[model samples]
Target: MVAVALAGGLFTAASGCAAEPPSPRERLIQDLKTEPQFKDYSDKQVECLADAYIKYAKPEAIELIMQGKTPADSGWKDGVDGRTLTRDLAACNGPIAPSPTG
Candidate 1:
């Protein structure tokens, strides 16, 4: 009986220790929130920017940004077409979309 109770406790503890990692979108939002340039942005603005980035930016660009590279970086810029990305993200300009100007 005591062994059973101990095993149950251990199982419960182990289960609680496992936590799901944040999704890519969530990570983008967190990255934006931490950026000095976005310091003044509201949560809603951050979410909108993250959504726009995911939808319009190239996968490589998104990956680079998530890895802490600025859009101005040569590798990051190579992955993004500024005009097209900016145009596609225009509707999300409620708080000014992220610029490839970096």
Candidate 2:
């Protein structure tokens, strides 16, 4: 689950980095910057994507969303990886949110 992967990544980063690790929101922004689907995105697209992502987030991830963090949640399975997130987002219709790419 996301909790497990987050825990793992958090620990690894904490152990390896002398500086602060990127916060969830920062990570989200960084990831968004690299997303191919988001490349042509203007400001509207950024907001739209963020808004759309919020609508699709897992129930547990809603809080992080409210806090403007990444859509990572404890309820999500780590089996859902980054590639899956993009595919899922692209495939999504209505309000179905993509899972975290752990």
Candidate 3:
């Protein structure tokens, strides 16, 4: 019975270790998934968008997000030249389909 109790205690201790929290980039991807602008995008597309933000957006933009700020609140657009970010994000967005309203 003592051996069984010891085994149970070991199991409890092993399971008590918590998993590491998500990284900043992972948090950014999760945040992007909830954005209305990305509503039509697939998970892969959202990940791509996050990658673009990491690569093209200013370092401060990502840092702000890591500090619990939303991308818009972080002034993501103003962080870097819009044109460059636009060009990089365009690749992630792929070919745009014509709007059904049109």
Which one wins on TM-score?
3
lDDT of 1: 0.75
On the 0 to 100 scale, the lDDT of residue 64 in model 2 is 59
**C-alpha positional error of residue 2 in candidate 1 after TM-score superposition, expressed in Å:** 8.5
Instruction: Identify the runs in model 3 with alpha carbons over 4 angstroms from their true place.
Output: 63-85, 95-102
lDDT of 2: 0.57
Residue-pair clashes, model 2:
1
Model 3 over residues 1-102: C-alpha lDDT tens digits? 999999999999999999999886798898888778889997878888888877766667777765766665645645577788788788778744556877
Tell me which residue pairs clash in candidate 2: 56-97
TM-score on alpha carbons, each prediction: 0.59, 0.31, 0.63
The best-first sequence of candidates by lDDT reads: 3, 1, 2
RMSD of 2: 18.0
Q: Model 1, 85: alpha-carbon shift in Å?
A: 5.1
For candidate 2, lDDT tens digit of each residue in 1-102?
A: 999999999999889978778664455555565767667665445554554454445645745544557764453444556675666555433233445652
Counting clashing residue pairs in each candidate, in order, gives: 0, 1, 0
The lDDT per prediction is 0.75, 0.57, 0.78
Q: What is the lDDT of residue 9 in candidate 1?
A: 100
lDDT of 2 at 42: 57
